[model samples]
Target: MHDSSVFLIEFGAIILGLGLLGRLAGRLRFSPIPLYLLAGLAFGEGGLYPLGTSEEFVAIGAEIGVVLLLLMLGLEYTASDLVSNLKTQYPAGLVDAALNALPGAAMALLLGWGPVAAVVLAGVTWISSSGVIAKVLGDLGRLGNRETPVILSILVLEDLSMAVYLPIITALLAGVGLAAGSLTLAVALGVAGLVLLIAVRYGRHISRFVSSDDSEKLLLVVLGLTLLVAGIAQKLQVSAAVGAFLVGIALSGEVAEGAHHLLAPLRDLFAAVFFVFFGLHTDPSSIPPVLLPALALAFVTTLTKIATGYWAAKRAGISARGRWRAGGTLVARGEFSIVIAGLAVTAGIEPSLGPLATAYVLILVILGPLTARYTEPLARRLTRRPRPEQPLAPPAQATPVDDQDTVGRT
Candidate 1:
């Protein structure tokens, strides 16, 4: 067979398979991410039917997938929204970092992976998938709940934090000197602040500059601009994903909406490819050895995330049930986790990190929805058990649940 023919067949099969997996996940009311990852494993280096001709193409698609994921995420918030959430929710963000990130870092140290791997692992655990959480909230019809804002505020903080965090990891993974890494960090912070300033003050101008009546033109311009910025950011050692996100933030109004509509399909395609690419590089055989550790990590982090959400919601004066729901909703970790681990895996920082991350993510992403739906109910049920010894008190008047500040549904 000609190499071109082989490439066409291989890539076509992968796409078709991803579409089917996505449909299956939809029918099951679950995220398609785990299925995509599993498919990648089935076609990976140590698994069945590895591709010979299309791996390079897949790798390129995967990089674009990461950029698109971050870009779309940034589009979900305006600069004003970010500032508001930051003011109201900085404490939750702090607790989130302390609870979820610390465990991963501790695990890395326990495994003797050193400081760089520890930093990378901390990030892998720190971020919850905004993509997954948003879907679950919509599916569960809890978007209008009082605690929803609390959940979103934390997610926004995480997304913004990546603008700074990605550069630090990049420098560490590349084994740059302290001075060079400090310079890179400074540049990243400066860029992030400048972009935020531009987004807040000149977002309308940017949108107008990028806007087009023609759909094709709009798509082309937005995609081209994202890739160009991403490339330059990578050249500057500032992380391509951050550049793409900043671009997304800088655009507003009609341009942001049009770009989102035009780019969503591409984002889905590339994001699926990105997950597959992560799975493709991981040796399936390596996963078994790490499965127990991954399960343990997932369990511990799940509890920590719940605590983070609960504390944040309680602080916001949400109802008990809403607080539990908020905690449960934030338990899933998806795209960002893989992206973080993928970087370290590519750098050969630790051989076991990839497989461990794969196993951990698989457990949590699947578990995330269940927790979101049932956490409040389960907590209620447990507390409602009748005590045999105490005399039953007269039932108190039922208090009306007032979910105030119920704005921002879409």
Candidate 2:
């Protein structure tokens, strides 16, 4: 076969394999993320077939995928929702983050990694896979339930916290000499926040321009804006994902229904490319010999997230069942974890550490969806009573119409 044909065949195989695995995962009551990783491994250097792309391309694709993911998240939430859910969600988010970070850092130390490496590793474990959790809930037709909304709200809160934490952690890893850069990052974030406020303030007016009768033109404009903001954020040395997210949040309140319709296809297409690209970069051979330590790190981090999230949910007046569900739902990690881990690697943390981090992420990606699938059942069993339904009132009846007729006749 010609080289071009080989490339096409490999690409097609990947897509088909991922789709098949995803469907099969549903049937088997597991999340497809692990299968995607397995597919990557199978096609990777260690496996039978290899698509020998440079690391740069894969990294670029992964970065774009994560930015788009964050943008979608931002598009789904509003400031009002944040405010309303903050009381319960924020505490839960904080607890989960703290639990994941502290124990994870300790585990990293136990593995004989440096403090900076440990801190970054801990941060990776701190975040939950919000996308996976949301997808699972929606698939199960539980998205409309009260608990589903609460879990989603908490996930959003967690994302917001991560948005702040990532930069700080990045700065720390950049070393003491880069304190000025950290300060600059702080200012840039503040400016981004201001820009978001302005966008929200004028979103109604902006929507008029983008929500024309011309669907094609409107979509083009929205896409253009998304890319433009993403670029500007990148130029500012702030996270492009943050800019994309802010844009989404700005437009979320006014243009949600229309925006969803317009962006759905584009989002899915870009997102699939992103995940595929994410998988394409994995060289299984690079995974460090410290597999035992990596596993230990992943286990501790997962447990911490579960315990702290559950405690916070309970304190927030969630039922015992809801608490259990929240805990399990929040334990899965994803793209952001990988992003932070990658940043650490780029910052010269250590060579072996990056692969270790990747392995941990791979594990969570597998476990997150599976745990989420069964969270509801576990919650029900733990909290056992069916919640009472609201009672209906009896129908009102008229006294005999004949009596009224007789009185009128008299």
Candidate 3:
């Protein structure tokens, strides 16, 4: 009875603190991710005053947080969309991996962390933060810009790649041999292919099966299904995140929309907890030792991400300004990077990895928004390029992109 009371008091205070921090971040027009990590650090193992009872609950919440994060991300597109993006935008995806992932792999090897840790860190650096980028696009009104589709295509490809990448990492971290790891990869690929096939052919039927007019029933059913699949996936040695993502892809139309609308708040709450939970396990003192390495990584990857965006946009024939925007937009790394590092940390792969990832993400997540807003303008200033001049009289307005049929075409 005493323990229960303490748990309630500690957790209640945590939620309240997160709320206040989130509010502060909103006022500053910044993501609250860094602040949440800081909160966790202050209250975690080596920090000010760690809580005893709530750590277990926070751990569970964090896992759910990761599952929900991937699930909702899947809901944003159809299986067909993933296929199409892969077909059309794979060049960008390959370039993205080569440019962004290699640096991380190099860093890990340079630190003598071995091949497995290298692969893990490669993922940590390769993927951009979809959540942060989506928000920046909305806030900046770039949704209709010429390069927006290019940016989105790159993001979609990244999401698709994770379906395969997560399983390989999971197997590697488990210390499975080559034969067993190959089997795991084959299984993951087969499952992904099967799910995509089902989604492409019978998605509507699946949606109908899950659909409910009552919001309460709908919410429970969808959430229950996601968790169930996630658990089974974990049991099968596939990543639970991949399973949740597949479930999301399997639902479409009204069902997907309703599920997304219903699940977003829950996702946000759990996702915040997940980040804090990661911090809870990391010692604050470990971070300073890794701070310089994290900074170097963050700097190098920022440029590489920009280069990737620029190259991708150029391939799609975007203008100089739009290209810069696309590159700048991909600079921030967030949830996915941590998700990768979290797997490694949980596997006890390297003592320094968790601290390094924590510091690295904190730096980039904060810088992501600033880069998104400024990189293009900064490029212009550096080049001393004058803005295209308008005629004295209001020139004939160009036809809308749809009518003109080109500028923003993907």
Please give the CA lDDT of all the candidate structures.
Answer: 0.93, 0.66, 0.92
Q: Per-residue CA lDDT of candidate 2, range 195-308, in tens?
A: 556665776676666665667776777777878888887666566777778777777544655666787756654555454554444566777585777788777776776676
**Candidate 1 C-alpha lDDT tens digits along 1-410:** 44898899999999999999999999999999999999999999899978788999999999999999989988878888888887888889999999999999999999898999999999999999999999999999888888998999999999989998999999999999999999999999999899889899988888888999999999999999999999999999999999999998888888889889989999999999999999999989999999988998999999999999999999988878888999999999999999999999999999999999999999999999999999989998988968686587777898744445355443
lDDT order, best first, reads: 1, 3, 2
Clashes of 3: 0
**In candidate 3, which residue ranges exceed 4 Å CA deviation?**
385-410
State TM-scores per candidate. 0.95, 0.80, 0.94
Against the hidden true structure, what lDDT does model 3 obtain?
Answer: 0.92
Candidate number with the higher TM-score (1 or 2): 1
TM-score of 2: 0.80
